[model samples]
Target: MDLFKSFSTLAKAVPLACLAFGAQAETWKYAIEVSQGDIQDLYAQEFKKRIEAKTDGDVKVNIFYGGTLGTSADATELVADGALQFANISLGHLGSFVPEIQLFSIPFILSENNEVNKHLMTDSTTVYQGMEKGFAKTGLRLMSIYSEGEDAWAANRAVRTPEDLNNFKMRILVSPLQVEAFKDLGSSPTPLPFGEVYGALQLKMIDGVGQPISSVYQSNFFEVTDYLISARHQLFTSAIITGDDWFDGLPTERQQLIRDTMTEVTHYMMDEVPRLEQEFLAKILQEKPAMTYISLNEVQRDAFRARAEQTRQKFVQMVGSHGQQVLDGFLAERDRLEQQLN
Candidate 1:
């Protein structure tokens, strides 16, 4: 049977959907904080539009974007604490609670187009039905997942290989697996909140940052970092979350509306985010003819690939046996979805 089938069965054992079409007189505050004028800001605005239309304004989703709510780790923790109701959390922040989320840090695991929908909606989805039950005690409900392509580097210097990344202190979201991998690369990595990046870079507090080109462009980091290098170093994905107890109180129809709507948003984002990123970057450079875009040689890329495998091994060891099983199932589902994409 397919992974979705398994998910359906699992969801059925939990609660029925399709009973929550009506809107409730509730106010919602969401945090998306990735800065204001970059590529992600555009897509985030679109998502807000959909949510508004879906609820017809009865439910308001206030965006505490650009660190008004908190950074990646704080977003997850606040949602769990119920201090915040909704958030867009990076998977790498899983170090705070779900270390298995680290398995995706396995280098080139998601560099190709084949990885997009691979993990969005399968039985091995981001947070499993039973596993999510654990979050109930913490007061959070893992909601929709949106795919992000592999992350690259934004630096002041040209980086074509992992060796080049050596001694390159970069700012990465605080994750034990990622921190160690960067440390192994001969670079000093300091884990910090996303909100602190701009000032840090401006102050020369760090040397470089590892993120997708889209984010770099969206957050206007290209303004600070003169070089944009496609290291395709790591594949990253994100999860949308809400309070678990709050989610359970919603009617089935309302629940189904979100499930179906976000599924559409997922596909939309998969195509739109990347497409817009290219346009934005092009316009950015065209406007700034003095900027540079570094191209990595094939041999160097392969060297980077070698490091990817080593990183994956580290993740498996770091996450432990139970975490490995989750990784296996997620990869299996990811491979299947890749076939469909191909």
Candidate 2:
């Protein structure tokens, strides 16, 4: 009778002990190297919320925003090495590590229709799959890929045609494709770090910077530049990435949770981008009435597109045959989806 009572008591206490130990939750740190008011910051905060709630606090996300960790490049390195668990990285920053990524940055590669964003999300999209596969080889998993809007020209003078771009020194991302594309378009592409761009523009070191309207608004470039031309050139694609080793180490359910949560965030950002573009443009119009905001007509847009096409081979040569295969697959898928949409 005494032994039976003792065994029953021990079994009851086992549950309590398990609960106590289980209280120690799995924690992760997410790093964002951009400014606070940007869309990526918003996505990080919401991502934290969703992960915690969905996991019922079993998993916790700690967000370090505004380069609290380090510069964007530093953060990306940390994430790739698994020192940082997650990061939101611009495609340009990723090209050096995964040359195949440079394909997406090629000028005028993506369609203007917002639905093109949605099409890339499908699992069967060849280029998207290829990029994800390529990223895997570099030890990074691409959780989400979406547009933050298109790149625009923020110049001291209005740039209406290719001639206007001649002799113009423009700030570009560090991607070679960007340099080649702008060079073909008759501008002197000056690749500069994001931090140096504002001072460079103010000092007339560079004549203009190419970025999205949201970026111009966030970076306060509108105060320094007099023209905003909607190039819609290069749909700026960004990816949410995590270290493959770290992700793979997680429980299967946790992996799925993160993937699903990020997918939801990507879709939300896609819808948010155009609206934010309008918001930023409206603010620019109201505050800087003298700033010229020009939207290109079909003929002008075609001219820019034709020039961009000339840079495609340059990108292919940079990445070689494998990269060309990815580009061809993406173009075919893009065309197929576009036709279905029409």
Candidate 3:
């Protein structure tokens, strides 16, 4: 009887002991705008796994997918306001908060070579030195920016040339650069919130959208649009951001762990995205046999490429001297990285 009582007492005391020592884990929220299995979700999952393991479960990450927490803009604002711990926001959506980031929205700004684009995103001083400061002003830390894949245009009709896009009524992100770029490519760009895209397509409110292959398949955009054009005009980029104040308040070791872990995840995403793009494209075709896939040849691509310089100028004009500095630095870094790869 004494032994039974002692064992029961010990078991009851264990809970009190943990409470007394303050051994409770911290739960952090990570908001992503896409559904599970999308690149952002994949990145979040990998980050959650590594961060939990690294911290020995002292910190836990809860991922909110498909705008459950809110839209991309809402989630980003939450992070900036320190109400949310982390979020994965596309540069397209982020342009509203930090307009200079619209630099990435310029068509064909990144290299067609995936390896060069990967290095540019990971190591470019323009991003860390120039764009990072822009993010800081918004009270968010730019953890890392990574590419999902080249943007593929899905339209109601085939788009072999810029002429085909004339008055096509395309759905574009709410970025001035995108609006200008598509206008230059001869489309009537309609900026719609992401959630409204499918209905907009089904209702003919907009003709089509340009998104990564993974996004088209995952979001079921393949079902709504008739053609998937691999224009490769731009790379779909997303930033993993966190609350600046919250991140800065962390201990030095914790901060380093986060930076190191984010770097690792960025590299993994860069490598994994290309493969996933191909896989997703195959799935889109298999599921929607009637949907046509258009791959623009170099000559055909050049037509769209020719219009890019005009939009690039428009970007600098919209952003001003500071934007000019970032754009110049970005192009220089891109050139240097491309040469190094060669």
Tens digits of lDDT, candidate 1, 184-205: 5556787777767767777778
The C-alpha RMSD of each candidate to the native structure, in angstroms, is: 11.7, 2.9, 3.0
* Better candidate by lDDT, 1 or 3: 3
Point out where model 3 deviates above 4 Å. Answer: 1-16, 19-22
Q: Write model 3 residue lDDT over 1-342, tens digit each, in one string.
A: 999999999999999998879877889899988888898899999999999999999999999987697777789889988888989888887887778888888888997676787677766788877777778888988888888888888778899999999889988888877889899988999988888898888887888998889999988998999999998888888888899999999999999998898888888888898899999999999999999999999999999999888997888888887777888899998888788887
TM-score of candidate 2 to 2 decimals: 0.91
Global local distance difference test of model 1 = 0.67
Cα lDDT tens digits, model 2, 273-305, are: 889989989998899999999998889887888
Ranking by TM-score: 3, 2, 1
Clashes of each: 11, 0, 0
Candidate 1 Cα outliers beyond 4 Å, as residue runs: 1-25, 81-83, 114-131, 148-150, 184-186
> All candidates' TM-scores?
0.82, 0.91, 0.92
* lDDT for position 47 in model 1: 68
lDDT of 2 at 328: 86
The models' CA-based lDDT, in order, is 0.67, 0.82, 0.87
